[model samples]
Target: MPKSPRKRALSSPHDALFQWTFSQREHAVGLLKAALPSSLAAAVRWSTLRVEKGSFVDRALRSRHSDLVLSARIGEGRVYFYVIVEQQRDVEALMVFRMGLYMMRLWEQIVRDQPGLKKLPPIMPVLIHHSDTGWTAARAFQDVVAVDGPERAALLPHVPCFELRLIDVSGGRAGDLVEQALTALGKVVLWCLSVSGDDARLEREIARTAAALDEVLQAPNGLAALEALLRYLVATHARFSVRKIGRLLEKAAGPRAQEAIVTTLDEIERRGERRGRAQGERRGRAQGRAQTLLELLTARFGAVPAEVSARILAANEAALVAWTTRVLTAPTPEDVLVEDGKRPAPARRPAARKRARRS
Candidate 1:
């Protein structure tokens, strides 16, 4: 069954690009075929593969997960494949353990949705790490456990286990991964992933994927996709802004592609300006709320301690509003600022104070 698209927020530029590119059936197929073991990729019916909208990521950990789930039929059984684009900059030591937790969530959802399902479907975990330094963490669940050589045989049965199929987006081998891709857009996507955050490599890769980039511009909604790609590159690549990308596109892509490239760059710049202004407005609103909250606290109580003032200033708009709401009812700064499951710092104010009685 095709799942309806879920409303989920993307955490970063790389995540936005990852989901956008792979959500397409063609691009998804290309990655599965190119990166998976030949026998494993061949056993499944490619036509059965479809994106599953319900993400299994934990809400609090959404920023780190950047997950996409796809389901396909393998003969009489249904199989799922989970993709996680590791968004953090450094290699995570606990990643395999985290994947184990995610798998449990996926299996729980499958059972709930199906009700009387007798068997659990297997999930093939794919981890795409784009950290420039490359992945150094353990790849298999068993490898993460502390069981030593002497105890390996004794405790092996009880250990939770699964392995990750890594699509590493660093080192020169990523170019080889791109070469195995079947779709032009997939090739461009993989290349972009490979070169993100490296100024020199990104410039060099643009020249390499120029043909694929041009091919992308010819697809339906091609201009929009290209604009997204350009925006991603500009945002990640240290040296290239939209202007620099446009100038490079002019020289490298030549006359035929120049006009469209220029238009794409113009759109990117316009959106960027609008986004900047909107972000500025958000900052202004947060600052205003913080100031208002500080003043109210001062009037109701006394001078807010330096630490409390800093906390108010650093808070988001929502936090400020919540604190302000509590100011009317709550007794002290500690009570007003208390968050769920969290206690505020010890109050630094005088232990007792006289309250002015209303006439």
Candidate 2:
């Protein structure tokens, strides 16, 4: 089944973006480092060993894991790395809360899992936002701090954050990178991925963009990434979000890029169509079942009101599903009510009886 949207809040845009861009856990790590500064990138070893935990809020507690993790040996001390990629086009203030929770959990896990280790390394939370919201200045936990007194203020140091703004690097810069990557038709690919709707106009823009990319970067991978991007757009049926665009870029890069994008896009579309059909069928069946029950109620209760029928139809799915299931075993409308776990109060029976007697 195509996965339903994730209900729990995500840690950061970094984590979300990582999953979208690179399907594989390890690839996300490599790609992340590539985007970071050279000094930090060189010291780190991207580890594929990921830890999974149950859903923080649910009963089944399904596992949610990190996007990429690594350990860096810096000045005789080993620092642990945890990165979450996000590609949201809008601000999500709630992410701070989610990240705070994840950070606490990670700290607990580190202590429990590695008892021999003396100390934990400074953990850096990185956010790579690709939104038209345009990049806001990078912020860290330290930035929000307030020292009420002079003594308290003296002890605190600014906690630097690892945040990168890719939006600052625009179309012209992107084309230059494509040229260096030696990809054929690089800019064309980028424009196609970025352009919204209007296929004919987009095609013209793509051709022009491709020519620009050719002017800058003459690399093969650039071309590959571009091609893969086009195929992905043609394949997947999603609105163009920054995260989706990043995913398309990742899907487009490499030797098998074109083929992979085609396959994945086709699969996503097929699964989406199937899911829609299944949901429709479920809804139709539920409606059918409810209609049958309404007819029975009208027959047994002597003309059930239209308002009551609408209420039943508009009821929640969980309630509707249960009610529909009960209808199969219920003998009458009264039986359906009890089967649905609704029972009349004994206190009301005398009044109902008096009213019926009077009528």
Worst 10 residues of 2 by lDDT: 1-10
The superposed Cα distance between candidate 2 and the true structure at residue 113, in angstroms, equals 5.8
Q: How accurate is candidate 2 locally (lDDT)?
A: 0.44
lDDT of 2 by residue, 26-53 (tens): 4334444545555666666545323344
Q: TM-score for all predictions?
A: 0.74, 0.53
Per-residue lDDT of model 1, residues 140-241, tens digit only: 999999989878978988997789888787654552253555678777777676666777776675677677777777777677677667766776765666
